[model samples]
Target: MDIVEFLSERISEDEAVARTLLGDRTVSKSGAWYEQRLLLECEAKRRLIRIVESARQAALAAMVSTPDQDVGWIPQSLQWMEQSLNALALPYYDHPDFDQDWFRT
Candidate 1:
């Protein structure tokens, strides 16, 4: 899956976890709780971003080191990382007016 799909899935999973921890009624009942959850989700996204970037850099270095062989996957992987990073940079759940459909464009 592309970065957007990956991050979206991650966010959904995090939300599910939060729901389970706070219960459905309490999950959205308090601003402080919601903010805390959102911060946690953002931290997860940041970690994913770092991991993807590191992998992309490694692929790039490998591609450069072995120029003779077919390294087409390196470019594709870089593109995926770039897209995912872009998606992760968005306001996402950090904003009160966040919209899931905004990423569709």
Candidate 2:
């Protein structure tokens, strides 16, 4: 699968794992409930972090870079933006089938 599809699947799988972990969980005022809820919450949050990171990277990979004419040796804002984007660990950038590299190429 392509990076987008691969990441999308990962996100779906992660969401499923999160849902499973959080299934039927309820909270009360008891200390035991609080402690157990904390553990489950941590696990769910970790999975959520991964999903969010993947989505953010995909968005970054899809960003179009438009460099303006440079004056002297100083870089322009768009150039900086392009450089920052290129420096990111975007998995979508590695796939040959991904067509978002038209501007980067």
Candidate 3:
């Protein structure tokens, strides 16, 4: 499943529900507040979904420019690497950069 596509579908659904809930009604003050909140939440999801590709690219860049090694930072970089693989449906340790033994240092 493409995560971004899945999220986009969800956002569409949320927007539809919001419209239906607020469509024909004369909302009270609190109802108006909730309606605004719901629309904002949907907008937030859309903004986040728009950045999914940027995240994937950043993760791939991390794999390409890894440090020689980082005791503290390697774990976080690994998480980013893992996220890239997850999005692409690749194996966890499929990249040459993951092989410490292959490095001359």
Candidate 4:
């Protein structure tokens, strides 16, 4: 599956696991939401870091005596990646919990 779909499926699976293990408690959603939020932030941070590194390299290349024509895309790429980072950093709120017995029931 594509990355987005895969991520969604994995999140769903984790929710299922949590619910199965703990039976829909009041805190289940909180735990799952926190976990997913953290994962998304981490992924976004990693992607932004990569984009920054690439931009730095491209900027350095452009500073040299003979700059590559492709250096023009560096700023635009950074902007786009920054927007993505911001989007991912937004807080997601949802909290639900399940009891272990809920699974057996």
Estimated TM-score for each candidate: 0.56, 0.32, 0.53, 0.38
lDDT of 2 by residue, 1-105 (tens): 433344454445545654555554563346445555655654654565455556555444445332343333333433444443333324345545444653363
**Stretches of candidate 1 above 4 Å error?**
1-29, 92-105
- Highest TM-score against the true fold, candidate: 1
Q: What is candidate 3's CA lDDT for residue 78?
A: 51
1-105 per-residue lDDT for model 3 (tens digits): 444454465567668887777875777778767877989988876765556566656666666687554445545765654454344322213443333322212
Decoy 4 TM-score against native? 0.38
Candidate 3 vs candidate 4, lDDT winner: 3
Error of 3 at 62 (Å): 5.3
Q: In what order do the candidates fall by lDDT, top score first? A: 1, 3, 4, 2
Q: How accurate is candidate 4 locally (lDDT)?
A: 0.49
- Please report, as a residue range, the 10-residue window in candidate 1 with the lowest summed lDDT: 96-105
Whose lDDT is higher: candidate 1's or candidate 3's?
A: 1
TM-score of candidate 3 versus the correct structure, residues matched by position: 0.53
Candidate 4 on 14-98: residue-level lDDT in tens? 5556455445465576776776665665555556556655765676666574564555665676566444533432322121322
CA displacement after TM-score superposition, residue 100 of candidate 4 (Å): 46
Q: What local lDDT does model 1 show for residue 100?
A: 46
RMSD of 4: 14.7
